[model samples]
Target chain A: MKCEQISELLPDYLQGSLSPDQRRTVETHLEQCADCSEEVAIWQKLSLLPVEQPGPASRARFEAVLQAYQAGRSNQPAHNSQWRKRFSSWNVFHWLRSPLGAAAWSAALLAIGIFAGLRLAGPKPPSPDLAAMQSELANMKQLVVLSMLQQQSASARLEGVTWSTRDQQLDPRVLSALLHTLRYDPSVDVRLAALDALSRHSAQPQVRSSVVSALQEQQSPLVQVALIDQLVEWHDRDARPHLEKLRQSPNLNPAVRQRADRAISKLN
Target chain B: MTLAPDEDLMLQVRDGAGEMLGVLFDRYQTPLFNFYSKLTGDRTLSEDLVQEVFLRILKYRQSYRPGTPFRAWIYQIARNARVDHFRKFPRQTALEPEMLPPVVPSDSAQEQQEVELLRRALRMLPEDKREILLLCRFQELKYEEIAALLGCELNTVRTRIHRALQELRKSFHQLTKGTAS
Candidate 1:
């Protein structure tokens, strides 16, 4: 067999898919050709190379992404139904149709309001189980928020940021996801919502530093102003340099620059 | 009967059975990781790319055509994920030893040296040739299947693989020569 023809068959030969006759021909050519023999040896060694095992972190990251996707899928319908159930229970039109019922309902609401005021005045503290339940619920809300923040829809991401404000207790993942949204979310509304959510967690040192770090990267004037306000409120002196940079940036929005200027002086 | 095919699992995922993707992920995660690892020689980046590929599959599941080969479709996504990653991080093309698996006590010195040389030589090959070679030799994909995945003729795939092997041979020779010197 000609070397040219043998070269064409080399791929199949290496794969062991070549016919016996073809393999014999290529082997015959290799016996006489030093270069072709070397080529075959190279491929033989190449095919024997070991596969690398991915680190455990790879699987963890994949599971995280898959779980986020699955959570987003499952909750999409649940979210719609929850709002439906909430509004469906209002029955305002039915209440208006019956004046007696409306009066009774109003009296009940007044009594509940007075009772709630008394409870507030007495400062009834939550039991341990209740506090634990609330904490678990907060963590669940954080997961949902993190999942929604990954959605393609800007409104969904905005809702995510809004959901993060449902409880005072914050998950570190929720804080990071909020900060990520603040830094990278494409929609101005989503970023603004994230900035607002982060402000709610401003007391946490990590959240404070995240907001301070995000301040240098934020472009929108409204978000920049909001972040500057949070940093100034926190009295985060570490933000002085970034705020100074924002104040001097040529493209700094006038409103944002003013906020940054005031924030810098406050920190100083 | 053989178990439910990957295509069926993916179709289920496309049809709102999102958890079915777990099956696909378990099946393809390692292959996809090895694919990226071979292409970039960066384990961490390869893992990220594997995750990105699965995410893309989920995101674009609606576009999957029934009766198409699931392996090819997934591999196509894998290739695109690697390209997109490189596009985003252009300066990360240089292969680092950090990507190589940690040496075990059982491995011989010569074996490790040969593996290192092979890796360096593979890295020296042009990107397309290296990818085709890896797909064929390492991933064990048939040339015809690759042709279908790449939207090219079978002969084109065969010729590309052949030439890629030749180029790799030249690279291996040069690398070994450099080592000897």
Candidate 2:
């Protein structure tokens, strides 16, 4: 039989699924045909390529990811997320329909009316010390972020990280808080969000350094991927050595290791 | 006693036996890692994708049904994870000579040289052909499973495998002759 004729049987033959008669036919062909025999030989030789094991840390990384996934799952039940949303909105409507809600609504309206009356009928308090008031409002926003960052719920902490990104200039304390969250947040979601928020502030030298440090300290693969991506986005060549160090680290998550290698290449 | 089948373990995991995933992970990680590393020539990416496959298994565990073959199902997920990753991070660097796996020490110089040529020849195949070859040869996926995983007919899978071998054989022969000359 020609090589073409036997080629049809060769794949099945390699798989050891051939009928005895077909197997003999291919074996006869292989003995005569060097090209076809080489193909079989090459397939056999493929096993010579050693099997590489994932680094020792792979399981630990999976544990971390699984824990984070389950924690996220518990907070918002999987498959019932839309149901939870509808239920919460219905609860809000029910609360608003209560007598207590009506009274509170009435009091808020009355207070708004009296405040308007006082503002229009009384003196205007000399322009309200505009700059100081604005500064105080900024302080208030940062304070909310700080408190939110300390919240026990990962979602609230995630929101806190989001809130931190709304300001053009960050308070030192809030910046440090975000850095800490990026480094040590128990929840990978919160840590990723913290990284996202801090990514926009790379103009700050401190932001760059802390992120590089986080690249080393983060055990979660997701956050580590984000950190390296951020450094690459910023085109920070100084991160090269840090990435190398990370790539060299024992038990580093494989995803992060890949990103670091990619980032190092891009920055170079 | 026989070990719990992957399908049953996966069903338990689906039914909320989270610990069962550890068994699945341990059984599959090395083969899956080799699958990715050989395909992409990137060990780190391969390892990461292995983790991704498990995470996705957890996320989509509900989709798994009682009769579904767990190996086929997981390979389906594995293929998607890799596709999704590349879709997100497009390939930037083509594999260079420097990027090949370090040549493993072998019993004979000729074997070592042939191994080096084979790696280069395999790398030279277009990714789709390379992938089909890897799925069958390295991954040990059966033709029927590959057909289903690739969403193609069984015969097509066989034909593709044959064609991939032809391409591989031609490349390997040419490389060997070039080195000989």
Candidate 3:
């Protein structure tokens, strides 16, 4: 092969993309030519530069971008107004009022009513076993929802959250959101609600530990009371240390202190 | 509600869901920026190009099809932005390793200097060849993707990349010769 023809194929040769015949010719030429060999090595080096793994700053930039996206989404209308309009045209209420639709709606409400009544009547004191199971289900659901949310647009996910009644037992996604809010939510009421949803899972050692930690860390008396209530249901010896700490904590609200006192009595 | 998929997100943006554009921007900004940085050999220009690519993507979102590979589509935008940049300010010559500032030092100065020498030699090649080499050898893009993005045939992408590497190799040898002398 002429020098020019061989040179043109050097990139392919370096990348091992050259055909066997062309590769043989290049290999033969390189054996006789130091210049061509060195050229091939340089091309090899260019290909080897670590271009894929972005540096820390670039990762930070990416995170900032995601955060900005979240913030921007928050500023827009909370729901897809167009979707709401479309759904309105479908007149879900009108459909639900039809005989079959009314039957389904009544059946759903009756099921919910029965479940609520059973829960209220049978559990003046929450069952540790049921709470633990509910919490586990919630965590699993949250993971699935998070995975789904990542795949979908923020607005659609937010709309789903806003429209749907919070189901701590069945919807792990809602539980995840509640758990997240409990940890970082600015509103004491929301945090307390999150803690209540989280309490359903306190039979799990991790959930119990998290509740105790949140109780200790939280400055809000109401949230602390909610945590103490959760601890009372836990009946775990693991909760003893936190209950003791809450008992001695002078800054704690009297109601919270009273709850902690009762929880400590139960633990002992 | 489940989060919309990538195609759905793009469709939302295309249909005037302006806020959803941020999601696409968030998704791609880092990889695209890294690609631009390697391509331009300038961090500042790379950052600017990243923003420009997204802005253009937002402006032209209406043209995008939902079912397309979002990565390829976004990259096509980025590739066009880089081309437009080059047309506006043609470099006097390809950048030498010395012309570009050091990012991080390699193990030995000699080794580092050699790498720099290779980089500088690369900068000296014609723009089309430099880009093809960078995309294939540096960015690791497939010939087909490169062909699609560059509006060329797959064989042409391969051919150009091969030629670019040859040109870079020849330049490196000359540099080494001068150093030896």
In terms of lDDT, which candidate is strongest? Answer: 2
By summed lDDT, the worst window of 10 consecutive residues in model 1 chain A runs over: A80-89
Question: All candidates' lDDT scores?
Answer: 0.72, 0.79, 0.62
List, residue by residue over A95-201, the lDDT tens digit for candidate 1: 33445445545555565565455557656645664465455545555656676677655555666688788867777788788878888887655675687777776
Error of 1 at A47 (Å): 3.1
Minimal lDDT window, size 10, model 3 chain A = A147-156
| Model 3 CA lDDT for position B21 | 70
Tell me the TM-score of model 2: 0.59
Candidates 1 onward: DockQ, in order: 0.32, 0.45, 0.16
lDDT, residue B157, candidate 2: 94
Tens-digit lDDT track for model 3 on A99-158?
544655565566556556657776463677457555554444454344323223333333
RMSD values for the candidates in order, in angstroms, are 18.9, 10.6, 22.0
Candidate 3 displacement at residue A49 in angstroms? 3.2
Model 2 lDDT per residue over A210-241, tens place:
99888777766656766787787777889999
The alpha-carbon interface RMSD of model 2 comes to 3.0
- What order do you get sorting by lDDT, best first? 2, 1, 3
Runs off by more than 4 Å, candidate 2: A73-268, B97-108
Would you estimate the TM-scores of all the predictions? 0.56, 0.59, 0.45
lDDT of 1 by residue, B12-118 (tens): 88776777888888888888888888887778668767866887786667679899889888898887877765553465246554455644434568777777778
What DockQ class does candidate 2 belong to? acceptable
lDDT of 3 by residue, B1-181 (tens): 9766778888887665666776776666666766776666778678757755765564456578757866668778888888876764567675655556643443557776676667677667776777777666655566777888889887677677666766887887787776666
Residue-level error in angstroms, candidate 2, position A73: 4.2
Instruction: Please report the candidate that would top DockQ against the real structure.
Output: 2
Model 3 chain B lowest lDDT segment of ten: B99-108
